[model samples]
Target: MARMKKNFITSLFDTKGKSQDTEEGLTKIISDFFSSIFSSSNPSELDILKASKGIKSRMTGIMSEALGSQYSAEEVKDAIFGLSPTKAPGPDGFHAIFFQKAWG
Candidate 1:
């Protein structure tokens, strides 16, 4: 039996108090809003760069601990085989099950 699809609230407001209902209009409004925010000049580069060192060092420490561990071939095989064959592929269009089959 097929399940009935629920309607979503796609209505959005534009910058000049304008209401958007069409898919294209909603997409354009979102693109314009995010583009404007991203295109704005950043004056806090120095502050952001200084903040990176602390987080970078902490992340590197965590990665080092994991990277230092040795994994058996059976462990790698088990991990890949655990994924369901019917699961959808990621954006790269390569399904994870492909790797599992390739291991044979």
Candidate 2:
């Protein structure tokens, strides 16, 4: 089956309310609009460190757990085979049936 052609909008209004015809002008307008909405000023260093201090530090534990855990091929095979066969193929055009058969 042939896919339908997608039409792109060519013009945009800049921050100065001026019409922009070129792609670069549109991109600049979008960038300037977003930058204006989401100002660059962020939380200070002390505030960041203060927030992180209360959160659980799991990296060290997770790394150790991962190193200690044993990998099982059966678990991977089970997971692949458990996928829904009725579901459509993903963007790569590969369906779960492919993995299901490959796993077996």
RMSD of each candidate relative to the true structure: 5.8, 6.3
Q: What residue runs in model 2 are displaced by over 4 Å at the alpha carbon?
A: 1-12, 35-39, 42-44, 51-70
Per-candidate TM vs. native? 0.44, 0.53
lDDT of 2 by residue, 1-104 (tens): 12333456578987678899898998898888898787747758887799889999667978999878997999778777888975988788999898887664
Q: What is the lDDT, from 0 to 100, of the residue 9 in candidate 1?
A: 49
Lowest summed lDDT across 10 adjacent residues in model 1 is found at 1-10
lDDT of each: 0.80, 0.80
Candidate 2 CA-lDDT value: 0.80
Measured with C-alpha atoms, the lDDT of residue 85 in candidate 1 is 72
